[model samples]
Target: MPAMTEPKLISGNSNRPLAQQIARRMSLHRGMSVSLVDARVERFNDQEVFVEVYENVRGEDMFIVQSTSNPANDNLMELLIIADALKRSSASRITAVIPYFGYARQDRRTKARTPISAKLVANMITQAGIDRVLTLDLHATQIQGFFDMPVDNLYAAPVFALDVQHHFKGRLQDVTVVSPDVGGVARARELAKRIGCALAIVDKRREKPGEVAEMTVIGEVTGKTCIIVDDICDTAGTLCKAASVLMDAGATEVHSYITHGVLSAPAVERITKSVMKSLVITDSIQPTEAVKAAPNIRVVPTAPMFAQAILNTWSGTSVSSLFDVDTLTPIYEGLYHRG
Candidate 1:
């Protein structure tokens, strides 16, 4: 058994496989050997939620792994209920490890009479007694401000950069990183810098919500293999559209490295028929059956990154520095070496 402040990992019903993988990573190489503790979260006949922490969590620091993905409302309730249970059980500290933050896209009022649900969700978690938050590749960085507590917004750029480098190993110079929209230029640029590639942008305009978007290439992409980058790939409508424009602009091939794969509705079918060579997404959301059936879609695990973040946070080290190539490369190598 680990000590009281050893940072126990507890998971809700969301993305249990990811939680298990993270547990395995943390337990590697005779380190702390911390594993997940059981926290049974279930519902009643009338759909009322219930949570029970079997382990003695008194004074123990706990991190709850829950991605509010599809069926978002149910998962959100589960997270809140579990946190409430842990708090009442005398847990010293609780960090909500949300890999895919739901309602994050609604950080601001896009239209009149609409709710700022992101802030609402943040407030809900804070009121539930979570001391901190750990989430990956939020749809908006400003969502951190919504949380009054300490929020660590981890990036998938480092992971995607390493994978991109490996994929385009010898032909690195031929790769051009692209942003699917002007909004994502920063995220795309970060990955581009990490990969030592040039950057491009797709200028797009959206007139209304839930409508197909049109974009045009605004940078040199001729005869290059383009990798469009963004934080979320929901529905993949704009993504596939951008890929088509890139190919029309004479890009040899097009791929995307999106952090969240919210393949809602016809996303899988759209991507399957898109001009992109491949659509690489993180397992931030558990891949659905349709997502798995797509031949051109690749799913990458984010568990190792989360594990490192958890360990560093518990040890009072800098979790933000893990995105630096100088820092994360050796760490990832260590993971493979251990394997």
Candidate 2:
């Protein structure tokens, strides 16, 4: 491959710190020179998004790293505008690296008149001329099908599962992996299987947005340390409430491992006072000061993992092995879960 084909990563305001870190990690890991593209993302007096890519990206494989987080609409628009700018600049291939894919929870219609916003967002990106996409821990994995182009839905399971092993001192049997909601059973089941432990589900009923009516513990967790797992913790309502329910169900203690710490208003305060022992989340989205200040909330750097994926993509190698759940399970099973 020609040196000119090397990736040029750029950042948006949503999570520039993480994008910069991923670029540095990639260069260090592969011994290749990598730097973010020189660009300016600004807003006009009327709050309209504007993007300007200073460097010539003609024929370069461009990757724009942006997390459509907090200011979801604004950040999202910036991504689209930047992709358009890169396309106009003659970028060979444009990949939008969204660490946190917004509107993913609305992938399916619940109410009669509801729209599949996830698919709509997917359409917008493709329409903006994005050649591909790279994102982490989408709220719904099936949303990958929404895109016509290649969509790499990376997982945080390997990171969370390995941390669970270390957190429990390699004693897998004593741990119980839990799903905070029935919808998350698949995710919890994967982690539980990796640890070779039992699985439990928290039965929660949602009355409306941001409101969980009731929660019940579904399986045995009485004598074990329960780790509640989920994808995104926007309001943390589900996590905090489920932790309380688990503790009340005779569990010794509770902890949580979530992918994106959206940590919207009151999320940090609720998490800090919750019954969970600790809450570990990946730095997919740049954590807020409140998230950093919360004692129980811990942020894990995902730059190393993303760095590996970026290198694999640039080298024309398959990036699937980076976080393949099944491949990682047997290793832990042999190490400590053996009878």
Segments in model 1 whose C-alpha atoms lie over 4 Å from true places: 1-4, 29-32, 334-339
lDDT of 1 by residue, 1-339 (tens): 334367789988879889988998888822757778976888899998899889998898889999998889999999999899899999988999999999998889977999999999999999999999999998889999998899999999988877887677788899999998788889999998887899999998887866655778888999999999998888888888889899999999999988999999889999999998899999889998888889999998888789889988777778999777656666677433211
Off by over 4 Å in 2: 1-4, 325-339
lDDT of each: 0.88, 0.86
Q: Write the per-residue lDDT of candidate 2 for residues 1-339, one digit (tens) a residue.
A: 635477889889999999988998778866887888898999999999989889999999888899998799999999999999999999999989899999998999988998999999999999999999999988988899999999998888887876777668656677899999888999999888776889999998988989999998999999889988899898898889999888889998899999999888889999998898899999998998888988999887777778777777777787788776554445334333422
Looking at model 2, which ten-residue stretch has the lowest summed lDDT?
A: 330-339
**Candidate 2, residue 181: lDDT:** 84
TM per candidate comes to 0.95, 0.93
Against the correct fold, how does model 1 do in TM-score?
0.95
